[model samples]
Target chain A: MRRLIVGLCWVVIPWYLLSLFVGSRVLPFPHAVAIRFAELAPSVLLRHAAASVLRVLAALLAASAVAVPLGLAMGRIPAFDRLLAPAAYLLYPVPKIALLPILLLVLGTGDVSRVGLLGLVLVFQLLLAVRDGARAVDAHYLLSLDSLGATRTDHLRYCVWPLVLPRLLTAMRIGGATALAVLFFAETFFTRYGLGYFIMDSWMKLAYLDMYAGIVAMSLVGFVMFVTIDRVEQHVGRWQG
Target chain B: MPGVTDRVIACRDCAAGYAGRDVFTGVTLGVAGAETIAIVGPSGCGKSTLLLTLAGLHRSSRGTVLVDGTPLESGDPRIGLVLQQYGLFPWFTVLRNATLGLAIRAKRSGRRFDAAGAADIARALLEQLGLGGKESDYPRRLSGGEQQRLALCRTLLLEPEVLLLDEPFSALDALTREELQDLLLTVLAERRVAAVLVTHSIDEAVYLGDRVGILAQNPGTAAGEPARLLLEANPAGRRGVGRTDPLHHQACAWMRRRFAEAVRA
Candidate 1:
């Protein structure tokens, strides 16, 4: 709690100074934004924030479901890695948000297109991280397991999966940030829902207070998610220390 | 004890090396039930390779490894190997590491595993090994001796007829090393399992081995030829011997002198 207050002081003071220096309505004082954020938070921003959070949650699940098994396969099996790595390398770095127009046209501005874009942002990060994790399992551990007459499935369950978990959680935290960036771009396109659309709409109308409220809501929601992932990591990866 | 009863694990004329080069050649040893044959040698003598062959972790390039008269295959359930570093899985708690061997066996055999029963068995084994009340702790939290004990527990849980250790105690301090050596003897006596231990310490070999094998280079052989391992009986009969036993000291001194001569030759 003390650390949080000290950290807030670092950011809040800098921003207050910046606002005072700018002397423009564009970047309002910290007090104005905070008051406005309090007013709009409960009724107006909550619904949009919920929509964005749900989309991100769905993307996280879908990306993990598709990537984890495939990443593990690539890591553990050389032949599988040889076959899949070429295609993954080609597609991983292409800007996913660039496909927003096509996605909106095909999926018709629904939640599906937005979620798909966010999924694209997160999947590669997770896949590469998990694959590297799997490949790096100590040969000694495998030898130990094999001495017990382990089947291949047992090797995966007893050795590879547990070793890969810490790396996977770290990748999730990194991927979460990229997914949010893509989420803003996706929601700006064809939706009335989501914090992204709310913030952009407020900015267009010169309602700076509403814009700041939407940004704060989105930051809080993302913080909640990142905190949740951190908590899970602490629970499962305690043995790392 | 090593040669009196029928051999539980036998390696005949075994030669092991990687990439078509022979590390050790013409190695032969037979371990009877409740007997421990310890191998001591200079580094790179292929002592570990010899142990690996017996455990079926490595193939004998020019010979055969037989477990109870059956040819050895990789991942043989009848053989359990403890590595040099005590290879306990850091990700697992103490209890989980102890029971993983049984769990792996059950999974492979397609039997219905009773997790509760396995846990009970592991709890008893950990308690016996002086790891009581530490079942929930990760391996990293344990001391080196404790980690070695955990590795021993993991291997022992599989209930193998034969145990192979590769320099299992070389990393410990002198006192911890001696204590673990005693604990190991008690475990082996209680279990009556055939064991082959590879070590650098002549004292450790003389203290634990029913017969101590000296492994060294074949100085007179040609460039392509590998090293040799030869076994000799130990009169100390390690069951009750300790640091104060004059007989153990004599055997260790004699073995050390012989070890120097063998490696030099």
Candidate 2:
């Protein structure tokens, strides 16, 4: 708690001092932004925040649901790994944002495409994380499970899934940030509501205070997502501690 | 004592390897029910490979491992293996690790496993093995010796007909090693389960084995090459026997000479 307060002071104080020196409409003082944020909080800010959060959550859920099983299969089965490894290697490094145009063409500029774009961006991060995590599991554990007559499903449930969970959560934390970035970009185009759209609209209308407020809201969402993931990791990775 | 009988485990000219590269071949050995056979050899001598083959974790490239006069299938649960690293699942709690095999068995047989009953059995075994009150703790929380014992507990809970242990105590300090050895002896004596123990320690080999086998330098390379039986001495009566025992000392001396000879050859 003390660390958070100290960190906030460091950032806020520097920005406040900088704003005082700039004395420009583009860079509003912190108090002016705070007042603007309060003015917009009840209706305009809440709706946009809700829209952005919904998209991010939906993308994360969809990505995890697809990536985890596919990753585990790729990791555990040598033949499957051989088949998919080259494809994963080729596709993982390609910037997913670059596919925005292709996705936009196929799915049109609807919520589906936006969500699909975000999900597509996050899936590779999660898949690679889970695959590497499963591969990194001690061979001894697998042998032990095998010696115990663990069937394939038994091995997956008891051994593979639990072992890869922490890595998957870590991947989620990383992918969450990427998802948010992609979400902002996706929302900016053909989106009626979102923090991204709000911020861009505020900027165009010379509402710099409101724009800062939108940025603050987006940062809070990212912060909350990170903290939530950290907390879940702590709970599941209790043995590690 | 219930399953203790003349259910022999025999490796008949067994050959095993990885990726078509032979590690060992023609490894023939036999253990009568309730007998403990300890194998001693240098590193890369296929001692562990032989154990894995016998346990059915590794498929034999030649011959067969027979349990009770039938060829053993891969991953036969009746033959419990304790690997050198203990092989405790890090994700599972102590109690859960102990009951893993039984739970799987239940699931396989289409029987609803009595979790409460299994927990009671696991708890009793843990308490007996000096792991009382650590049922909720994961394997990472336990010391090396504790983890080894928990692994043993997991195997024992399943009542395996034969036990294949690969250097089960090499990582422990001398004192802890001896303590675990004694505990192992007690368990074997009580259960009378047939066992094959592979170790680099000559003294441990002599102390644990009814008969000690020494693998050749590059065992199982040729068609006829296999682990040759080095000594046949009953150490069963020597339970709790210290290193000072004349027979124990004699066995150790004989094994060391034979081991040096095998390595040289």
Candidate 3:
């Protein structure tokens, strides 16, 4: 908590200094932005923030639900790895943003398209991370469990799952950051419900204060996601500490 | 040491190696219930490989291993192994690591796991092994000796008829090693479980083993020749034999001389 406060001070002081140096409507003071954020949050900012948070979370869950199992299979099953590894390797490097238009066309301009695009962006990272994690289980632990008369199911449950969870959580954390960035781009198109729409709409009206407020809200979403993941990681991988 | 029919675990003419290289060959041994046979050898003499084979975690290329007069099976619940590294899962709590064997047994046998029963059993063993009040602590937080105790506790949970240890206490400091050696003595005597202990420490082998075996390659043999076992009864082998006992010292000295000749002659 102290570190967070100190970090906020570091960022806020420089930001406030920059705003004063600019001294124009384009660069409002941090305090001025803070007041505008407080005023707009209760009415429109909260709703936009909620929509954006929901879309990002839904996308993250959808991607994880699909990718984690696939990645675990790839790591453990040689035949499955041979089948899917080439596809994952080939598709992982492609800029997922380029598919945004296609997704928007197929899924329409609803939240589904935006969520789908963000899910596509995050899945590859998580898939590769989890696969590597599963494949990297140490031989020592495997032998230990084997000598205990553990079945294949017991091996997966006791040995593989616990060892791989921390890696998955770490990948989720990194992926969440990307999800927020891609969420911003996704919200800007054919949608009036997200922070991306509100921020861009505010910018068009030259309401710099409101745009800053939307950006802050979006950052809060990311901050909360990260903190949640850290808490879960702590609970699962406390032994690592 | 005994007739093959009276042994709880017996290995005859067992030879094992990785592809393209032999590790150990022509090994024969038998352990009756509650007996311990300790092995000491030069590095790369395949003492660990021999123990792993006995544990059924490795396959011997020749001969047969019999447990209770039946052919040995991989992952047999009646045999437990304690490794030198104290193979407790870091991601699990001390209690969970101890209970893991029971859970594996339950799942392997198609029986529904009774969590409460397993916890009770695990807690008792942990408490007996001096790991009480540490059920929730992960293995990473425990000291080296504690981690080893947790490993021992886990293996003992299965109540196996035989135990195979590969340098189980070589990592601990002197005082803790002696402490654990005594603890192991008590447990082995109480449980009447047959055991094979592999260690570099000749004193440890003399103190704990009813017999000591040396695995060493022949001095004139080619580099490709695998190490072979030289098993003998220990002069000082008995329960609670003092480390400084004259017989213990004699036994350690005799074994040291034999082991040196076996490894370097």
Candidate 4:
């Protein structure tokens, strides 16, 4: 009950403060910003929010598909770790936004480019988390498993997977947030829909109230997404103890 | 004496070590049914490595380890080992872990678990070990003593013919450690399982072993193999029957000198 009330307050109070009062110039009354928010229309907000969420989720799914396997392989095999670790370090230092021009050039200014760019950024983050988590597993546990006559595959599935999964979920939480942030910047480049495009459009038109409103929308979406994943992690991967 | 009893595990001219240096060379030992041998060694000796080799987890550079009269292979199932680390799978509930050995063996045999039979045995074993009412608990939730007892239960649940204990009680407090040591002696006796227990404590070796084997380390050398069983004294006698007798004390004194000599060798 308390949580529900708090959630309602978070939504209602922020919408009023951003849409009604704060603006490029002080408004005499709350009615003017309210009229402008109404002008943005329900259809436009729904369409743009849907587009943004679909793109981000698609990118995240793609990233998870590729990065998890690659990370697990690198972690299990020492030679692979040695070969790929340096390259991963080198690529991670490069700001993901810097890849925007190349992505746009190759994939064009469509949703494809935005989703692909988001996935690319997420790969480095999730893979690093997987590798570190796998490496952090206790050597004794692996040795015990080996002594039990477990095959390598058995060792991996039974021992390594459980040990690393919680950490992997944590990584996803971080990676998802980063992907969302990068998507905003990436979309600001060339996009017809999404909250990023909406925010830039409002700013260009000098509608400061709409700009703040879009910012609030993006923040709310990111926070909700992160919290939802965190809760799922706790439920699905109950701590061993 | 050798073949009459049917030697379950035989380490023949075995040379074992860590990181390439031999700890002991041409070391021969035979463990028969219901026999309990304690390995007593000074600190930094290769008792742990020897246990690993005996368990068939490590390749002996110079010799062979035979189980059930056949050459033992890597990760041999005939040998069950418990380490001081208490390497219980933290993700598994106590029940799952206790049945892990049976499950693995059943899978290998292409047979499903006799669930009722296995559960009955697991419950009885846990009850004996004082871990009843905690079947659903995971390893991390257990205290150190509980974990050690669970580790014991897990090993015993397999009903392995030969048990290898590598300093299984070193991590516990002194009282708990001694209690566990006694519990282990009782369990091994009850199950009639041949066991090789490694420990740094000479008193423990003397107190529990049918025959205590002493190992010594060379100074300034990590690679020097601990000296072989220069002294094999049965202070505790058969099944620890005469453990507190004067004969036990005299045997301990004799073995103590041999251990000191091996260290200075």
Candidate 5:
């Protein structure tokens, strides 16, 4: 399949070079860099990969946890929207990367700071999307259900939820992608064991092939995550004509 | 059709509009078990507001609307209002949209919806509206005509005693408009429910309404503008009495005269 071809081109071939060429430095290609990769080993690579993924996932999950409820609250209550919306808009445009010094000062040089930075960036976009999407739901549909003697819970489940969910899923797709990209940069700047960190560390040691290998790994991870989310969207939206 | 004993709705002095401003005042109307009524008016004359008030979407500024002698309330299960916007939930499939009313009511009643029964009714109604085989599609994927049909089906599945239609077909092309108008006429005639429709087109007014009214705009003051019912005319009854046929010419003439009178008043 096309996916198989892509996997081979991106993951298998690059990883092969990483293992064979970068693993065993035989010439001007440098045994030092290969020795570095080998010393790290498969377990270290995996641990770093897992750590990086977990950090990104944690940031995304935390952002969504806060954003969904905040968005719904804003959409349902006009007073809350008026009170909260201006502050979010004002904060959203400030580049999240620029806040690293502040985050480091507050949280110390740890995963907490990295995750917090990425989450701060992601939540603003997610909140806006959720608030606007939920607000756009038709008043008539809600009123119709309400008039039908539907309880508040019934209205939320049957009418409001259905009306707003597709929009939320779409927002999640966009927010998740943005958060992943931000996570990469965050790792490059402030982590010891991620694809971002690996690339930066290898590049500093003049290991161009290993740096390329790290870049390839991070890209593959991002692509896989995006595709998985896209699949979820399709499955959930299947009933829609 | 149900017997005379099954008279389901009545509106007595059911004058309603917006708060602090009147649309139609001292307006009384009624629907027998299987009767249909339609209200027609010029642009911005408050016909839609009246329909909303009657359906319990808005509270009456002046009087009361009753269902089988019980006062109407917001979210009354026996009433449905279809605005020109179609208001189809963009996230829902055609089948889901159509069955939403039943689902909401059932959940409130401590019973879940009978999906098979709801699906059957929705399918039949969608078929009648020419939306067959498109049940799994979303509103965004549907044509304007198709979305309107889905809205109609959604309203019909609950078997509302009163249906309020606010220019439901005006958004479509001429051909589609006529086609939908005819479909609605056929459906309403068969269902025999009371309907109050606000329309701009005189041809549509004559074609769809059993009884039609031309409403006037209240002269604006330092306060907000109010709306007044200029005349409550029964086109069908007039035709039935051999006074005048509800033809295009007659309807147009009536509209022109009514418009001139409203302006003069």
Candidate 6:
């Protein structure tokens, strides 16, 4: 709590000083922006935040649900790894944001397109993370487990999943940040009900303070998502630390 | 207990290798119940491979490994292995690792895994192994000796009929190694499990085994030859005897001479 307070002071004081020097509508004062944020209807901001959160959550859930199992299979089984490794190497490097136009065209600019694009970006990140993590497990550990008469399912449950989870969470955190950034860009294109739309709309209307307020709200979303993942990681990987 | 028999473990002309290249072959050995056969060989002599084959973790390319007169199979719970590196799962706490075998047995038998019962067994084993207060600690937190004891505890909890150990005390300091060796002998005395210990140290082989087998490096043309039973001495009589005793020194001297000659040839 003390660190958070100190960090806020550092950010707020610097912004306030900069705003004072500028004294222009382009960079409104911090106090004015805060006041404008307070004046806005809570429901309006809440709805935008909720919509953005929903899209990100949906994308993350879908991506992990598919990627983790496939990644584990690829990591453990030589046949699956041999088949998928080449494709993973080929597709992992392509900038996923470039697919936005194609996704919008195919999915018709709906929430489906937005969710699909974000999920596509996150799937590769998570799959490769899990694959590498699983591959990194020491072979001796598996042999020991095998000698104990652990079945195939037991090996997966006791050895593979728990060992891979920490790496998976790390990948999820990075993927979450990337998803938010891409969400902001995707929101700028179509529809009217997201933080990106609200901020861009306020900027076009020359309401600089409202735009700053929208930016603050979106930053809160990112902060909350990251903190949640960090907490989950700590809880799951307590043995690590 | 159904498959338990008087014959503990017997290997008849077993051969093991990887990728079409043989590491060792034509190895015939038998270990009676409660007997310890120490294998001392030069590096790359396939000592570890023979132990793995006996434990059923590696397949014999030719011939057979019989555990209680039954052909050995991989993942046989009747045989337990203690790797040289002490292959304890880092993700599990010491207590959890020690109880893993018991839990698996319960699940295999379609019985409810009584967590409290398993914990009691694990706690007793840990206490006996001198790891009483370290149950919740991960393997990484324990010292090398403690980690070794924990690995032994994990395997012994299952009451295996055969124990295959690969240089189980090679990594420890001199003092810790001796202490662990004594502890292992004590445990084996009580459990009466057949054991095959692989080591590079002539003293360790002489100190631990009822009979010491010497494996020659058959790297190229001599791949299918069996290891010769180099020495059969009653080392168990010197259990409480000091290492510096005249008998111990004589045995060590004799083993050193024989081991050097075997490796050179």
Against the reference, the lDDT scores of all candidates come to 0.87, 0.84, 0.88, 0.78, 0.72, 0.84
- Backbone clashes for every candidate come to 0, 1, 0, 1, 8, 0
Model 2, span B1-265: residue lDDT tens: 1232234788666678778866766666778878888888877778898899889888888888888878888778679999899888777799989999899888877899999999999999999999999999988889999999998999999899999999999999999999999999999999999999999998998898877788764432454344443435544344345777786776677768767776664
In the order shown, the candidates' DockQ scores are 0.78, 0.70, 0.80, 0.51, 0.44, 0.74
Which regions of candidate 6 are displaced past 4 Å? Answer: A39-41, B1-6, B217-231, B235-241
Candidates arranged by DockQ, highest first? 3, 1, 6, 2, 4, 5
Per-prediction TM-score to the true structure, in the order listed: 0.93, 0.91, 0.94, 0.86, 0.77, 0.92
Off by over 4 Å in 3: A1-4, A77-83, B237-240
Instruction: Score candidate 1 by lDDT.
Output: 0.87
TM-score of 2: 0.91
- Top candidate (DockQ): 3
lDDT tens digits by residue: candidate 4, B1-98: 34622588877677877678777766678887888788988776678888899888877888788888888876677788897798888788888788
Name the candidate that leads on lDDT: 3
Candidate 2 pairs with clashing backbones: B25-B220
Interface RMSD of each: 0.9, 1.2, 0.9, 1.6, 3.0, 1.2
Error of 1 at A193 (Å): 0.7
Name the regions of candidate 4 deviating beyond 4 angstroms: A1-47, A188-193, A201-213, A236-241, B1-6, B103-121, B217-226, B231-233, B242-251
Please write out the lDDT profile of model 1 over residues A1-241, one tens digit for every residue.
Answer: 6745786688689888888898648788778888998988888888999899999999989999988999999999999999999989988989988888887888777999999888888899899998999999998889888888877888899899998888899999999988988888788877899999999999999998789778878877877888888988998888987
Candidate 5 to truth, TM: 0.77
Arranged by TM-score with the best first, the candidates are 3, 1, 6, 2, 4, 5
Clashing pairs in 6: none
lDDT of 3: 0.88
| Per-residue lDDT of candidate 1, residues B105-145 (tens digit) | 88777897888999999999899999999999999999999
